[model samples]
Target: MKLVGKTAIVTGASKGIGYAIADHLMTHGADVVITARNEAELATAAKQLTEAHTADKTKAIPVAADVSLAADITRLFERAVEELGPIAILVNNAGNSTLDLVENLPETDFDAVVGTHLKGTYLGTKAAINHMKATGTPGVVVNLGSVETFGTTRGNAHYSAAKAGIDKFTEVTALEAGRHGIRINAVAPGAVETPMGQDATTPEFTAAWHRTFSVERMGRPADIAKAVVFLASDYAEWITGITLLVDGGTHLRGLPDYADFLLPTTN
Candidate 1:
């Protein structure tokens, strides 16, 4: 129960990596507020966390909100603090992706992806720090980064670029916020098995996963979750401004051939 009485807000907690992170936080004992774009799915996740007898039971509140939208983001934070008290931890895990060549990528797709990943992370970190400052809690903020930031994928310029921004942002935020007793860090996950990961799986993608990754299989959401929980814990209270890559050495190799997505496939 490292987080025994802490209150946390996890965006994109409806499923996948976000869900795993939330579950682990609950297991370690924290009042968690979950957010996602899907209302029904978010509510269902809330119920499960609540019924599973999570930390402080009923500390789970589900608010469906789009991280890309300012109004929704505000609601998520305000409601979370209102219902769960002081916000001590925030996991900005929401994300979106675009898998097309830079030339072929839709402008709207690029904007939305940036809005969600880059801008959303920015808004979330700002909100978390402000809330902490206001409550004098001096909490922690975790942003989801990607090995993609350090590597190359033919069709993921935007995703990689945004994540790279997050890495720098984490460092800058840590430097600025540390004096206030708040810690900030970014977690760069290698390829994890999530809805987006599954949607991206193809013969080439699967082969690349096995070949590029030191591990023999795709990463599980729990794998990333454990790393997140640790950084959010007192165990890492002195740590900040680092991008912890949790990809089983996949990053040790290099990025997969994302250009495969653009190749013509045989029926």
Candidate 2:
């Protein structure tokens, strides 16, 4: 019960990495509010969480709201505060992807991904900070970033840009929030196996994942969730303004020169 009595709000918690993070926090004794755009899914997740943590220690609430919408974001925060008390931790995990070449990308695609990844993080952090500052809670904000911030993907320019923005934002927020005893950090994951990961599981994606990753297989959402718990815990009380890449060594491998490999070789 490392997080006993702590209150946390995890956006995009209907499933995948977000859900996993919320589960981890709840297991460790945090009262969690799980937010997502899908009402049914969120409700189901919240029920499961409550059942799993039914020892009278942790609690979970389901909130349905689109993170990209300002109104929805506001409502989420307000409802979270009402249910869980002043939040001590926030997991800004809601995001979407726009995978395509820069020229082929639609305006809507850019808007959606950026709105969800960058703007959503901005809004959640802003709302949480206001409450934290007022309550003098010295909270923690964990932004769900991506490894694309470090490197580029040929077909995912927009997603990469938004993620890169998150990287910079995380650092700036951490530096500024430190004085208030708040800790801000970014978790940049690569090739994690989740709904989003499965969506990218074409042959092209498989090839790319294989070439860039040193690990035998794609990463699990649990991998990222564990890191989040650490950062949110007093274990990493001194850590801030950093982007931890839970990418199974993909970044360390660096960007591979795939041009040569793309060419057909006569067998």
Q: Largest lDDT belongs to which candidate? A: 1
Scored by Cα lDDT, where does model 1 land?
A: 0.88
Residue 237 displacement in candidate 2 (angstroms): 0.6
**Colliding residue pairs in candidate 1:** none
List TM-score per model, in order. 0.95, 0.92
Q: Give the lowest summed-lDDT range of ten residues in model 1.
A: 258-267
**TM-score top scorer:** 1
> Which portions of model 2 miss their true places by more than 4 Å?
255-267
| Residue pairs that clash (backbone atoms under 3 angstroms), model 2 | none
lDDT of 2 by residue, 74-178 (tens): 898889888878899999999887455566679999899889988999998988788899999989999988887777546666778888888899999898889
